[model samples]
Target chain A: MHALIQGIILGVLTAGVYALMASGQTLIFGIMKVVNLAQGAMVILGAYLSYQLFTSFGIDPLLAIPITTVAMFILGVAVQLLFLRPLKAEDRSELSLLVTFAVALLLEGIMSVTWKTSVRSINTGYANSSWTVFGYQITLVRLWAFLLSIAALLVLYLLLNRTRFGRAIRATVQNPESARLLGVESSRVSALGFGLGAATAAAAGSVYGLLYPFNSGSHYDLISRLLSIVLLGGLGSIGGAVVGALIVSTSSAVVASAISPSWSEMTFFVILLLVLLIRPQGLFGTTARGAI
Target chain B: MQLHNRLRTTSSLVAGLAAIALVITGCASKGGGGGSTAATSGANGSPLIIGASVSLTGDFSDSGKAVQRGYQLWADTVNAKGGILGRKVQIKIVDDASSPTQVVTNYQNLINKDHVDLTFGPFSTLLTIPASQVAKRYGYAFLAPAGGGPDVFKQNLTNFFFVQPAPTTQSGDVFANWILSLSPADRPKTAAYAELDDPFSAPIAENIRTKFEAAGIQTVYKQVYPSETQDLSPVMAAIAAKHPDVIIGGTQSVDAYAQIKALVQLKYSPKFMFQSNGANSPLEYPNKVGAGNTTGVMSSADWFPGSKASGSDAFTADYTKKFGGTAQQVDDNSAEAYATGQLIEAVAAKTGKLDNATIISSLHSGSWPTVLGDLSWGANGAPTGEFNLVQWQGGKLLPVYPSGVSQAAPVFPKPNWGG
Candidate 1:
C-alpha cells in the first residue's frame, strides 16, 4: 500500500508534464491536419533555450518560458510558411511527415553543433528539494513543474475555446473549405495554430529540463513516448492526449512500484495496444473533427 | 468521400507508426566524407590514410566527437613530430549516426570503396562488434577506444584490440573488490544493482552484483532496464523503497545523471554508490548532476590527465593547448583514443612495417605503452589490464584504489547527495 500510494503520487506528478508535451502535438494535428513529427525536437530546443538563459543570465527557467515560447512560435511560423505551406492538398498529409522529419533532423544538427552533443541539465537551487507528505517524498521541482503544466494546460484551453483565433482554428479543423468560405484565412490560421502548438513545447520544455538530463539526440526517445501518448488518446484530440498520459503514466508507475520496474517499460505499449484494440478512434475522440 | 475519409484516417495511423519507426532507426549518415581516393603505400611513401566510422550525429555523438578529437589530436602530434615511418598520416572519418548496420556499411565503404590503408574502431562495443567483422573480412587491424565489452572479444577476431585499460566486463571488479577490502564497519551490508540493457553497461553491473553476493553482502534488488527507457522516476522510487546500503548503477552519462536526480528527488542516499560510467568524468558529472552532489560517488576509469602513465601529462598539456579547456576537462574517451594512436605508432615503429597483417601479428606479442598505461592483448584480443577506481572529491575525480595509483583513500559511508 505504501508503494502504491507513492506510485500514484509519482504518476500524477509525471502525467501533467506528459500531458503538456502531448497536447502540443495533438493541437498541431487537430488544426493543420499535419502531424508535426518535429514536436519532440522543438521541445528539446526549447529546453536548450531555457538552459542558455538560466546559465548565461541567471534567469530562472520558469521565467524564461515567455521568451522561448515567443522564439519557438516564430520559428514554427517560419517553418509552416517556408517549408509546409506550399504542399498540394492532395499530398499534404504524406509530404508533411517527411517535411517535419526533415525539420527534426535539421533542428537536431543545429543543436548538436551548438551544444556539442553533451548531455546537460538545468539545475535550480530548488531542483531536488522535496516535501515528505504522509511519509512519501515529493520533490519540489516536480510539484512546481506539475502546477506549471496544469497552468499551461489551462491557458491552452482558454486560448482554444475563448479567443477569436481559437474559433477560427476550430472552424478550419471542422471544414477547411467551409471555414475559408466563412472568411477565415485558413493558411494564416494554420500557421498560428502551428505556432501555438510549438509555444506549448516551450512551456513544458522548461519543466522538462529541470526534471531530466537532455541532449540533441534525446528526441529519439521522446518522439516515441509522445507518439504513444498521442496515439492512445486519439490524434488531434487534446483532451484525449491528457487522458492517455494519465493512464500511461499511472499504469507505468504502479507497475514499477508494485509489480516490477522491468515490466514498467512495457506498460506503456501494453495499455496503448489494449486501448487501440478496443476503441480505434480513442476515448473522447470523435469520428469527425468537431472536438477541437 | 467516405472511402477517402477512411483513407485519411488510416494514413494518420500509418504515419504515426512510420514516423516512430523511422526516427528510432537513427540512420541516415551525415555523408561519407573524404574523396574516394584509395590509400597508398607506407614506409616513406604517400600519406597513410586511416579510415574510421564514428557516431558523429546520433545517440553516441558526444563520445564519437571525443573519439574524433582524440584521433585528430594524435594525428596532429604525430605529424608535428615527423610522421610515422616518415610518411604523412591522413585520417578519413565518416559518420555512422550510431547505427550498427550503418557502421558496417561505413567500414565497407572505407575498405572497399575508399580502400584506406588502415582501419580504426568505432565508439561502442555495439558498433565495434559489427565494424570489427568488416575489418576482419578485409584483414585490417582494428584498434578501438570504447569497445571493451565481453561480446566484442567473443568474435574471436585476432585483428581487433580494445584500447581501454580494461574490458567493461571486468570494469566493476575494481570498485567491488575495493568495497570488499574495506573494514567490516565500512563495508556495505546490502547492495542494489540497476543497469542499462546495452551490451556495455549490463555486464559490468551484473559482474559487480556477483562480487557483492560472493562477499556476503545481501542482495536487496536488481533490475535491467532497456536503454531507451524515458522515465526513471518509477525505477528510482522502487529502489529507494528498498533502501539498500550501496547502490551500483550501470549507466552512461545521460542515464547516470538521470539516476542520481531521481534518487535525490526521492531523498534516498546510499552509504556507498559506485557508478560504472558517469561519476568518473569530472567534465560530465558536475554540470549535469550538481557539483556538491558529486562528492564521494565512486566510479572506475582507465585513464585521467593526472595519471603518471607514459605520455599522459603531455597528452593533457597538448589537449588543453589545442582545445582551450583546462587539463581537468580532458575526458577518458579522448585519452583512450590517443592511447590507441600511441599503440598504433609503437607497433608500426617496432615492426618498421605498416601492413595490416604485420600490425596484427605484432600486436598479439608485445606490450605497448599508452596514456592509459601498459597494455597487452591476449590471443583473442582481450586486454591484460585493469582500471583504477576513482572517487569524486573536492570537485575532482581522484584515484582511490590500487595503492600504486592511489591519490587519496576511498571514502566509505560516502557523503549523502547535496552534502
Candidate 2:
C-alpha cells in the first residue's frame, strides 16, 4: 500500500513534466500540420544547454531555464522560417517529417561533437533529498519539477486563450483559410508556435536533467515516448496531453510498484494498445487536427 | 526525331561501356590488390590496431567511459614509451550504444575495416553475445574488460578471453558459503522462495542455487526474470509473502539499485539481501539505499580499497593520485583494461611479433603483475583469480571474508534487522 501510494506520487510528479513536453508537441501540431519529430531532439538540446550552464558557469539548472528557453525559442523560429516555411501547403505535412527528422539529426550531431556522447547527470546537494507525506516519499526535485511544469502549462494556457496572439493561433488551427481572410499572418503564427513548442521543451529539459542522467542520443528514446504520449493525448489537444501523460506514467509506476518491475515498461504500450482499440481518435483527439 | 533518338542511343552506350569497365576494374582489384593490401596490413610492418565497442551514451555509460579512459591512458603511456613491440599502436573505438545490433555492425567494421589485431569490448552482456560471434568468426583476439554474465563466456569461441571472473563462479559461491556458515536453524527453508535474475545476475543466481542445494538446503521457489525487465516487485512481493529469510539479488548495479530502492519503499525488508557485481561499482550503495537498509546485504567483490590485500595500499595510492579519487571495486574494471595493454606488451616483448596468433599463444602462457596482483589466464581464457566477500557498513565497503584480506570485521547484528 505504501509502495502504491509512493508510486502514485512519483507518477503524478513525473506527469507534470511529461505534460509540458507533450503540450509543445501538440501545440506545434495544432498550428501546423507537420508532426515536428524534432521536438525530442530539442528537449535533449535544452538539457545539454542546462548541463553546460551548470557545469561551466556554475548556474543552477532552474536558473538556466530562462536562458535555455529563449535560446531554443529563437532556434525554433529560425528552423520554421528557414526549413519549414518554404514548403508548399500541399507538401507541408509529409515533408515536415523528413525536415524535422533532419533537424533532430543536426542537433544530435552538434551535441555529440560538443559533449563527446557521454551520459551526464547533475548532482545537486538536494539530489537525494525528499519529503515524506502520508508515508509517501516525494523527491524534492521532482516536486519542484511538477510545480514548475504546472505553472508553465498554466502560463501556456493563458497565452493561448487570453491573448491576441493566442486567438490568432487558435483561429489558424480552427480554419487556416478563415484566419488568413481575417488578415492573421499564418506564417508568423507558425514561427511563433514552433518557438513556443521549443520553449516548453526547454522548461521540461531543465527538470529532466534534475531527474535523470542523459546524453546526446537519449533524444531517440525520449522522442519515442513523447510521440506515444502525444498520440495517446489526441494529437493536437493540450488538455489531452496532460491526461495522457498521467495515464501512461501512473500505469507504469503502479505496475512497477505493484505488479512486477519487469512488466512496467510493457504496461505503457499495452495501455496504449487498449486505448487505440477503443478510441482510435484518442481520448480528446479530433479528425480535423492542425499541422505539427 | 532521328537526331534525338541517335543522341539517346549514344548516351546509353557510353554509360554501359563505363559500367563494364568499372566492374572489370573492381573484380581485378578484389582478386589481386585486395589480398595484397590485406597481407601487407597484417604483415610485420603495420601498426597494431586494437578496437573497442562500448556503451558511450546510455545507462552503462559511466562504466564504459571509465574503461575507455583507462584504455586510453594505457595506450598513451605505452606509446610514450616507444610503442608496443617498437611499433606504433592505434586504438579504434566505436559506440555500441548498448544495443546488440549496433554492436555486431560495429564489431564487423572494427575487425574487417579497422583491421584491429585484438578487440576489447562492447560492454554489457546484451551487446557482448552478438559481438562475440564476430570475434569467433574472424579469429581476432577478443579481450573483454567487462560483461561477466555466464552465457557470454559459455560459448565455444576460443578466441574470446574474459578479464573478469564469471558471475556464478564468483557471487554464487560466496553467497552459498555464507549461507552455510549461518546456523542451520537460522537458514530460511524455501530455497525456491528466494529468486533473483539479471542476464548478468543469472550466473551468480545459478551459482547461489547450486551452492545451496549442494549444501543440502532445500529451496522452495525459483524463477528467472529476463534482463529487460524494468520491475522486480511482483517477484519480491511473492517472496515476501512466502517469508523467506533471505533474498539474493542476482543483480547488476541498475537492477540492484532499483531492487533495493523498491524494497525500502515497499518496506519488505528481507532477513538479508545479497547483491552481485552490478552492486560493486558504486561505492555509495549504503548511502543510496540508506545505511541501515543495506547493512547486512552481502556481495562478493574482486577488489575493496579498504581491504588489507597485498599491494592494495600501493594501488590505492597510485590510482588515487592518477584518478583524483579513491579506488573502488569499479576500478577493477579500469585496472583490468589497463592490464590488457600490459599483458599484450609483455607478450609482444617475448615474441617480438605483433601478429594475432603469436600474441594469443603468448597470452595463454603468460603471467604478469597487475593492479589485482599476479594475473594469469586458464586454458578457458577466464581469469585464474579468486574473489572475496564484502558487506556495506556505515557507508563503507568492508572486506568480510578470507581472514587474510579483511581490514574490518563484518558488522553482524545490523542496525535494524530480524536477527
Candidate 3:
C-alpha cells in the first residue's frame, strides 16, 4: 500500500511535465492541422539553451524559461515562415510532415556540431534533496517542477480563454476560410500559434533538463512519447493530452511499483492500444474541431 | 510533356539519393584512387583505405563516436610514421546511425562498392555479427574496438577480432571476485541487481548474481528492464524498499547516472555500489553525477588513464595533442582502437604483407603489444586479459583490483552518498 501511494505521487508529479510537452504538440496540430514533428527538437533546443545559461551565468533553469521561451518563440516563427508557410493549403498537412522532419534533422545536426556527442546532466545544489511525507519520499526538484507546470498550464488556459487573440486562434482552427473572411488574418494566427507551441516546449524543456540526463540526440526518444500522448489525446485536445499523460504516467508507475519495472514499459503502449480500440477519439476528445 | 516531366522528377530523385550516398561514403578523406582489397596493394599508388560504418547520429552515437575517434587517431598516427608499407593510411567512416540493417548495408558497400583494403567493426554485438559476416564474405579482416558480446565469439568468425581486454560478461565476475576477496564481515550481507535488457548489460547482472549468491550474499531485489524503460524512479523505489546493502548496476551507457540519481531521490544510500561500464570515463561520469556523489562508487573497466602499459604514454600524448583535452581525458574506447591498429601493424610487419589470410593466422598465434598491455587472442578472436575494477577515491578513478596494477584500495561500507 505504501509503495502504491508513492508510485501515485511520482506518477502525478511526472505527468505534469509530460502534459506540458504534449500540450505544445497538440496546440500546433489544432491551429494549423500541421503536426509539428520538430516539437521535440524545440524542447531539446530549449534544454540546451537553459543548460548554456545555467552553466555560463549561474542562472537557475526555472528562471531561464522566460529567456528560452522568447528565443524559441522567434525560432518557431521563423521555421513556420521559412519552411511551413510555403506549402499550398491542399498539401500543407501532408507536406508539413516532411518539412518539419527536415527542420528537426537540421536542428539535430546543428546541435550535434555545437555540443559534441556526450551525456550532460544539470546538477543543482538540491539535485538530491527531498522531503519525507508520511513515510514517502518526494524530491524537491520534482515538486517545484510540478508546481511550475500547473502555473504554466493556468497561464495557457487564460491565454486561450480570456484574450481576443485567443478567440482568433480558435476561430482559425475551426474554419480557416470563414475566419479569414471575418478578418482574423489566418496566416498571422498560424505563425503565432506555431510560435506559442514552441514557447510551451521551451517551458517544458527547462524542467526536462532538470529531470533527465540528456544530449543533443535526446529528442529521438522524446518525439515518440510526445506523438503517442498526442494521438491518445485525440489529435489536438489540450485537456485530453493531460488525461493521456496521467494514464501514461500512472499506469506505468503503479505497475512498476506493484509488479516489476520490466513489465511497466509495456503498460503504457498496451493501454494506448486498448484505448484506441474502444474510443478512437480518446477520452476527452471530440469528433469536431479541436479547442484548447 | 507531362510524361517527360514525371520522368525528369524521378531521375532527379534518383540523382539526389546518389548524392546523399556519396556524402555518406566520402565522410573521411575524399577523391581517392581506385579501391583495393586487403590481399592487393592500393591501385595506382592510392592510400590504404580502411572503411567503417559507425553510429554517428542515433542510440549508439555516443560510444560509436568514441570508437570513431580511436580509429581516426590510429590512422593519423600510422600515416605520420612514414605510412604503413610506404602507403598513406586513409580511413573512410560512414554514419550507420546505430541501425543493425544499416550496418550490414554499410559493410556491403565498403567491400563491394568501395573495395576498402580493410574493414573495421561497428559499435555493438547487435551490429558486429552482421558486419563480420560481410567482412568474411569479402575476405577482409574486421578488427573492432567495441562489440565484445559473447555472441560474436559464438559465430567463431576467423575474420573478426575484438580489441578490448576481455569479453564483457566477465566484468561482473571481476567485481564479484573483489567482493569475495574482502573479509566476510566487510562484504555486504544483502545485494540487489538491476540491468537493461541489452546484449551487453544483462549478462553482467546474471554473472554477478551467480557469484554473489554462491558466496551467501542474499539478493533482495533484481529487475531487468527494457532499454527504453522510462521513469526509473519506480524501479529505484522498488530497490529502496528492499534496502539492500550493496547495489550492482549492470548498465553499459550513461544510464548509470540515472540509476544513481534515482537512488539519491529515493534517499536510499547503499553500503556499496558498483557498475559494469559506467563511471569509467572521468570526462563524463563525475560531471553527470556530482564529483562528490561519485566518491567510493566502484566501476569495472578494460583500461584506465594510469596504466603503465606499452605505448600507453604515447597514445595519451598523441590523443591530448590532437583532441586538446588533458591526458586523463583519453578514453578507453580510443585506446582500444589504437590497439587494434597496433595489432594490424604487427601483422603487417611480421608477414611482410597485408593479406587477410596472413593477418588472421598471425593474430591467432603471437601476442600483439598495444596501449592496453600486450594482448593475445584465442582461436575465437576473444582477448585473454581480464577487466580491471576501479573506484572513485580522492577525486580520481583509480585502479582498485589486481594488486599488481591497483594504486589504491577500495573503501568498504563506502561513505554515505556525497559524504
Candidate 4:
C-alpha cells in the first residue's frame, strides 16, 4: 500500500512534464490539422539551448526557460513559414508528416554534430534536493517542474480562452475557409500557433533537462511516447492530452512498483488500448472541430 | 538526309566509347592495384591491412572512438618500428553506427569487398557477437578486445579470439569472492539489483544475483529496467523499502547517472552501491554524477591507472599524448585494443607471416605479454585476464580488491549521501 502511494506520487509529478510536452503536440495539431512530427526534436533542441545557457552562461535551468522558449518560438515560426507554408493545401497533411520528419532528422543531425551524441544533464544545486511529507519523498526538481508546468498550462489556457488571437486560432481550426473569408488570415494564425506549441515544448524541455540525462537521439523515444499520448487523448485536444499523460504515467509507475519494471512500459499501452475501446475519442475529447 | 544519319551514328559511337572508358577507369581506381596475390606477403609493396567496423557515431561512439584510437596508435607505433614482418600496417575502419546488422554488413565489406588480410573486433559484445560470425563465415581470424559475453564462447568458433576476460558471468564470481574476503561481520547481509535490460547487462545481473545468493546474501529486491529508462524512482523506492545493505547492478553511463540522482532525491543511500559499465567509464560517470556523490561506489574494471605489466606505462603515456586526453582516460577498452594490436604484431613477427591460420595457431598455443597483462587463450578462444574491483575515492578510481593487484584498501559502508 505504501509503495502504491509512493508510485502514485512519483507518477503524478512525472505526468506534469509529460502533460506539458503533449499539450504542445496537440496544440500544433489543433491549428494546422497537420501533426508536427518534429515536436520531440524541437523539445530536444530547447533542452540543448537550456543546457548551453546553464553551463556556459551560468544561468539556472528554470530561469533560462523564457530565453529558450522565445528562441524556439522564432525557430518554429520560421519552420512553418519556410517548410509548411509552401506545401499544397490539398496535400499539406500528408506531406507535412514527411516534411516535419525531415525537419526532425535535420535537427538531430545538427545536434549530433554540435553535441557529439553524448548524454548530458543540467544539475542544479536543488536538482537532487527533496522534501519528505507524511513518509513520501517529493523531489525539488519534480515539484518545481510540476508547478512550472501548471503555470505554463494556465497561461496557455488564458491565451486560448481570453485573447483575440486565441479566438482567431479557434476560428482557423473551426473553419479555415470561413475564417479566411472573415479576414482571420489562417496562415498567420498557423505560424503563431506553431510558435506557441514550440514555446510550450521549450518550457517542458527545460524541466526535462533538469530531470534526466538526454542526447540527440533521445527524441526518438520521446516522440513515440508523445505520439501515444496524443493518440490516446484524441488528436488536437489539450485537456485530453493532459488526462492521457496522467493516466499513462500513473499506471506505468504503479505497475512498475507493484508488479514489475518489465511490465511498466506495456502498462501504458494496455491502458491506451482499454481507453480507446471504451471511448474512441478519449475521455475529454470531442468529435466537434475546434473543441480544444 | 543520309549525311545527317551518318553524323548521328558517329556521335552515338563516340558517346558509347567514352562511357565504356569511364566505367573501366572507375573500376581500375577502385580495385587498388589489381588485387595482388602477394598483398599479405608485402611482395607487392602494399601494407598489411587490418580492418574493423566501429561505432563511430551512435550511443557507443565514445568507446568506439577510443577503440579506434587504440588501433591507430598501434599502427603508427609499429610503422615507426620498421613495420611488422617487413610490411607497414594499414588499418581500415568503417562506422557501424552501433547496429548489429550494420556490423555484419561492415565486416562483409571489409573482408569480401576490401579484402583486408585480418580483422579486429568491433566495440561491445552486441556488435562483436554478430561481427565475429561474419569473420568466421569468411574464414578470417578475429581478435576481439572489448567483447566478454559468454554467448560468444558458446558458439565455439575456432578462428575467433577474445582478449578480454571469459564471459561477464565470471564477473559475478569475482565480485562475490571479493565480498567474502571481508570479515563476516562486516560483510553485507542484504542486497538489491537494478539492471539494464540488454543482452550483455542482463546476463551479468543474473549472474551477480545467483552468486550473491550462493554467498549467503539475501537478495531483497531485483528488477530490470528498459535500456532507455531516464528515471529510476520506482525501482529505487522499491529497493529502499527492503532496506538492502548492498545495491549492485549493470547500467550504462546515462542510467547510472539517473540511478544516482534518484538515490539522492529519495535519500536512500545503501551501504554499498556499484554499477558495472557505469563505474568503469572514466569521464561520463564522474562528470555526470558529481565525484563527491560517487565516492566509495565500487566498479569492476579490467585495467587500472598504474600497473607494472609489460609496456603498460609506455602505452599509457603514448596513448594520452597521442589521443590528447588525460592518462586516466585510457581504460581497459583502449588498453585492450592496443594490446590486441601488439599481440597480432608479435604473432606476425614470430611466424614471419600475416596469414590467418598461422596467427590463430600462434594465439592458441602461446601466451603473449601485452600492455594490459599476459594474455592466454582458454578453450573456445576466450582470453584469461583479471577483473579488478575499483572504488571511487576522492575523484579517482583506486583498485581495491584481490590484495595482490589492489592499490588501495576497500572503503566499506559508504559515507552518507552528502558527507
Candidate 5:
C-alpha cells in the first residue's frame, strides 16, 4: 500500500512534465490540424540544447528553459513556414504528417552528427536532492519540474484566456473561415501556434533532461507516449492532454509498483484502448466539433 | 499542345535522371569492388580484406566505436610489424545503425557482393547472431569480439566463433561464487534486481536471479524495465521499498547512470550493487555519474586493467596512445576486438595460408594467445575465459575477486551515497 501511494506520487509528478510535452502536440493539432509528428524531435532538440547550455556555460537546466523555448519557438515557426506552408490546403493535413516526419528525421540526423547518439543527462547540484514527507520520498528535481510545469501551464492559460493573440487562436480553432473573415491572419496564427507548441516542448524537454538520461533516439519513445496522451485526452485539447498524461503516468507507475514492470508499458495501451472503446470521441473530445 | 509536349519531355527527362541516380546509388551502396580488389589473394600479395558492419550511428555507437578502434589499433600494429603473413590487412566497416536487418545486409554485401576474404563480428550479441548466419551461408569465418551470449552458442553455427567468456549463464555462476565467498556475517541477506529488457541483458539478470536464489538470499524485488527506459524512478521506488541488501541487474552505461541517480534521489543505497555491462568500465560508470556517486558499485567484467595477463599493459598503453583516452578507457570490448585481430594474425602465421576453411579449422583447434588473455574455443564456439569481479574504488574500477587478479580489497557495504 505504501509502495502504491509512493508510485502514484511519482507518477503524478512525472505526469506534469508529460502534460507539458503533450499539450504542445494538442495545441498544434488544434490550430493547424496537423499532427506535428516532430513534436518529440523538438523535445529532444530542446534537451540537447539544455544539455549544451548546462555543460558549456554551467547554466542550470531549469534556467535554460526560456532560452531553449525561444530557440525552439523560432525553429518551429521556420519549420511551419518552410514545410507546412507549401502544402495545398486540401492536402495539408495528410501531407503534413509526412513532412513533419521528414523534419523529425532531419533533426535526428543533425543531432546524430552533433551529439553522436550517446546518451547524456544534466546533473545539477540539486539533481539528486529529495525530501521525505509522511514517509514518502519527494525528489527535488521532480518537485521543481512539476512546479515549473504548472507555472508554464498557468502562463499558457493566461496567454490563451487574457490576451488578444489567445482570442485569435481560439477563434481560428472554432472556425478557420470565420476567423479569417474577421481579419485574423490564419497563417500567422498557425505559425505562432506551432511556435507555442514547440515552446511547451522545450520547457518540458529541459525538465526531462534533469529527470532522465536522453539521446537523439529518445524522441521515438517520447513521441509515442505524447501521441498516446494526446489521443487519450481527446485530440487538440489541452485539458484532455493533462488528464490523459496524469492517468497514463499514474496507471503505469501503479502497475509497475504493484504488479510488475513488464506490465507497466502495457497499461498505457490498455487504458487507451478502454477509453477509445467507451468514448470514441475521447475522454474530453466532442462528437460535433474538435475542442481545444 | 506545346505545353503538353513540353511537360511530357520534362517528365521523361526527370524519370531518366531518377533512374540514373538510382543506379548510381545502387552501385555506391554495394561498396563497389573495394573488398574484392583488396582480396585479389595470397598469390598476388594483395591486402587481406576483413569486413564488418558496426553500429556507428545509433544506440550502440559507443561500444561500436570502441570495437572499431580496437580493430584499428591491432590492424595498425600488425601492419607496422610488416603485415599479417606478408600482406597488409584491410578492414572494411559499414555502419549497421544498430539494426540486425542492416547487419545481415551489410554481411551479405561483404560476402556475396564484396567477396571479402574474412569477416569480423558486429558490436552486440543480437547483431552478431544474424551476422554469423550470413557468414555461415557464405562459408566465411566470423570472429566475434563483442558478442558472446548463450543463445549464440545454442545456434551451433560452425563458422561463428566468440572470443569472450562463455555467456551470461557462466558469468552469473562466477558472480554467485564470488558472492558466496563472502563470510556469513558479511554476506547480503536480501537481494533485488532491476534489469533491462533486451536480449543480452535479460538473460544475465535471469541467471543472476537463479544463482542468488540458489544461495538462499531472500529474493525481494525483481523487475525488468524496457530498453532505452528514461525513467527508473518507479522501479527504483519499488526496489527501495523492499530494502534489499544487495542489488544486481543488467544495465547499459546510460541506464546505469539513471539507476545511480534514482538511487541517490530515493536515498536508498543497497549494501552492494552490481550492474552487468556498464558498471565494469570507469568511463561508463563513475565518470558518467559524478565520482563520489559510484564509490561502492560492483560489476562483472571480462577484462580488467589489473590483470597480470601478458600483453595487457602494452595493449592498454598502445590503445591509450592511439585512441587519445586514458588507459582506463580500454575495457573488455576494445581488448577483445584487438584480441580478435591478434588471433587472426596468429592463425594466419601458423597456417601459412589465408584460406577461410584453414583459418576456421585452426581457430577451432588451437589455443592462441592475445592481449585479452588466452583464447580457446569450446565445442559451442564460445571461448573459455574468466569474468573478473570488479568494483569502483576511488573513481577507478579495480578487480576485486578471483584472488590472482585482485587489484584491491573489495570495499563492502559501499560508502553511503554521496558521502
Candidate 6:
C-alpha cells in the first residue's frame, strides 16, 4: 500500500515533465499540421546547451532555463522559416515528416561531433537528495523538475489563451483564410507558435537532464514517447497532453508498484491500444481535426 | 566453287569455338570471385586494415568510446616510435550506433568497401552477433573487445576470436568459488535477478545462482524482468519476503543504481552485489550514494584499484597521468585494445610487411606482454581467459580473491547497519 502511494507521487511528478514535453509536440502539430519529429532532438539540444552552460560557465541548469528557452525559440523560428515555411501548404502535412526527420539527423550529427556521443548526466548537488513525507521518499530533483514543468505549462497556457498572438494562432488553426483576412499573418503566427513549442522543450530539457542520463541518440527514444502522448491527447490540444501524460504515467507507475516491474513499460502500450480500440481517435481527440 | 565453300566453313567454325571459350571463362571468373576479393584482401601485402565496429552513440557509448580511445592511444604510441615494421598501419572505425541492423550494415561496409585486413569490434554482446557473422562469412580475422557467450564460442567461427572470458566463466567459476570459501557462519541465503532476453545478463545471473547453491546458500527465488523496466518492486518484494542473506543483481549500471536506491528507500538490508557488467563502470557507485548507504555491497570486475598485485599500480599511474584521472574501470577489453596496438607494432617491426595473413599468424604464434599480465593466445588466437575478482571496501575497489592477486583481506562480517 505504501509502495502504491509512493508510486502515485512518483507518477504525478514524472507526468508533469512528460506533460511539458508532450505539449510542445502537440502545439507544433496544432499550428502547422506537422508532427515535428525533431521536437525530441530539440529537447536534447536544449539539454546539451544547459549542460554546456552549467559545466563551462558555472550556471545552474534550472537557472539557465530562460537563456536556453530563448535560444531554442530563435532556433525553432529559424527552422520553420528556412526548412518548413518554404513547403507548399497543400503538400506540407505529409512532406514535413521527411523534412523533420532530416532536421533530427542533422542535429544528431552536430551533437555527435560536439559531444562525441558519450552518455552524460548533469549531476547537481541536489540530484539524489530526497526527503520523506508521510512515509514516502521524494527526490528533490524530481520535485523541482515537476514544479518547474507545471510553471512552464502555466506560462504557455497564458501565452496561448490570454494574448493577441494567442488569438491569431487560434484563428489560423480554426480557419486559415478567415484568420488571414482579420489582419493575422499566418506565417508569422506559425513561426511564433513553433518558437513557443521549442521554448517548452528547453524548459522540459533542463528538468530531463536532472532526471536521466542522456546522449545524442536519446532523442530517438524520447521522440517516440512524446508522439504517443500527443496522439493520445488529441494532437493539437495542450490540455489533452496533460491528461494523456497523467494517464500514461499513473498507469505505468501503478503497475510497477502493484504488479511486476517488467510489465510496466508494456502496460503503457497495452493501455494505449485498448484506449484507441474503443475511441479510435483518443480520449479528447476529435476524428476530424484534433486527432491523428 | 569447292575451295570457296571449304574456306568459309572452316573460318566460321573457328570463330564460333573461340567465342564459346571466352564466354565460359568469363562466367567462371565472375562466379568464383564472389568471396575471393575479401579473402585476397585478407592475404594482401597492403597495410592491414583493422576494422572496428563500435557503439559511438547510446547508453554504452562511453565504454565503446573509451575502448576506441585506448586502441587509438596504442596505435599512436606505436606509430610515433616507428611505423609498425616500416609499414604504416591503418584502423578503420565504423560507428554501429548501437543498433543490430546498423552493426550488420557497418560490418558489411567494412569488409566490402573498406576491404579491411582484420577487424575488432562490438563492445556489447548484442552488436557483436551480426558483426561476427560478417567476419565469419568473409574469412577475415575478427577480435571482439567485450563479447563472449558460452554459445558464441560454440559457433566456432574459425577466424573469429573472443579476447575476454565469457560472462559466465568470469562471474560463475571464480567469483562464486571465493564466496563459497567463506566460513559457513558467514554464508547467507541468496536470490538473483536479471533482465530477461539479454544475452550477457542472463548467463551471469544463472552462473551466480549455481555458485550460490554450491556455497550451500539456497536461493529462495529467481526472476527475470523486462529490459524497459524502471522500477524493481515485484522482484524486490519477492526477494524481501524470502529474507535472503544476499541479493545478486545482473543488470546495467543505471538499473542497478536505481534498484539500490529503491531498496534503500524500502529499507531492505540484504547484502547486495551487482553483476560484473554494472559493477565495472568507471563511475563510483558509493559516491553516487554516500558511502554509508553503499557499504557491505560487493561486486567483482576485471580490474580493481586496491589490487597492488600485478599491473594495477602501473596502469593507474600511466592512465592517470595521461587522462587526468585514475583508471577506475580497466576491463579486459580496454587492456586488450592497448595490447593490440602494441602487438601490431611488435609484429610489424619483425616482419616489416603489412600482409594480413602474416600479421594474423604472428599475433597467433607469439605472446604479448600487457599491463594486465602476459596476454597469450591459444591455438585459436583468442586470449587465454583469465580474470580478477574485486570487492568494494569503504568506497574503494580492492582485489579480494584469486588469493594470489589479493592485496587486502576480504572485509568479512561486512560492516552492517551500525558501522
Give chain B TM-scores in order: 0.83, 0.72, 0.83, 0.82, 0.81, 0.74
| Candidate 3 ranges with C-alpha deviation above 4 Å | A83-99, A171-183, B1-144, B157-161, B341-369
Candidate 4 local lDDT, residue A253:
82
Candidates sorted on TM-score, descending: 4, 5, 1, 3, 6, 2
lDDT of candidate 2 at residue A220, scale 0 to 100? 84
Return the TM-score for each candidate structure: 0.82, 0.71, 0.82, 0.87, 0.86, 0.75
Clashing residue pairs for model 5: none
Model 4 stretches astray by more than 4 angstroms: A88-91, A175-182, B1-62, B79-119, B126-141, B345-362, B365-367
What is the Å distance of residue B261 in model 3 from its true position? Answer: 1.3
> Tens digits of per-residue lDDT for model 2 on B1-419?
00000012233343344345435544543323221133222355466678888778765666677677667767776787788755677777788766556666686666656656677766665565566666655556677766555555565466666665333346457666766787887765555422334334555677777777787866654656655443454445444445455677766554565566545544556655677654554455643454555666677776566545434465456556667865663466666566566666766667676655665566677665544445566765666655667776655677776565666675543445312
Give the interface RMSD of each candidate.
Answer: 1.5, 5.1, 1.4, 1.2, 1.4, 3.8
> Model 6, B91: alpha-carbon shift in Å?
11
Model 3 chain B lDDT-worst window of ten:
B1-10
DockQ (CA atoms), all models: 0.47, 0.12, 0.53, 0.60, 0.52, 0.21
State the local distance difference test value for candidate 1: 0.82
**How well is each residue in A153-254 modelled by candidate 3, as lDDT tens digits?**
888888888999889988888887889999999999999999999999999999989988777788988988888888898888899888888888887888
Q: What residue runs in model 5 are displaced by over 4 Å at the alpha carbon?
A: B1-65, B79-122, B126-142, B157-160, B344-368
Per-residue lDDT tens digits for candidate 1, residues B1-419, read: 00000012233343344344333332432332222213223335678788999989776776788899999899999999888888878888999997776777787778766768888888877678777876775567898887776667877888888887677678778998888888888789988888887656777888888888988999887888776766677777878888899999988667788888888888889999888887777777887788988988998888875998889988998999999889878867888888888987997778777777777888888788888878889977888878889999888889998878888988878888887
Stretches of candidate 6 above 4 Å error?
A: A289-292, B1-146, B156-169, B190-192, B213-245, B260-269, B283-297, B305-332, B338-386, B412-419
Regions of model 2 farther than 4 Å from truth = A54-64, A289-292, B1-161, B167-176, B179-198, B202-206, B209-278, B282-300, B303-331, B338-370, B373-379, B390-398, B412-419
Say which docking band candidate 1 falls in.
Answer: acceptable
Candidate 1 TM-score over all chains jointly? 0.82
lDDT of 3 by residue, B1-419 (tens): 00000012233343344445445654542444222234453343568778899889777776677788988998988888977777788889999987666776787687667777888878776667667766765567778777787767887887778887777677667788888998988899999898877766778788999999999999998888877775678888888888899999888666788888888788788988988767676777878878888888888776688777777787888889988888778767778877878887777777776667777778888788888767778877787777778899978998888776788888877877776
Q: How many pairs of residues collide in each model?
A: 0, 21, 0, 0, 0, 1
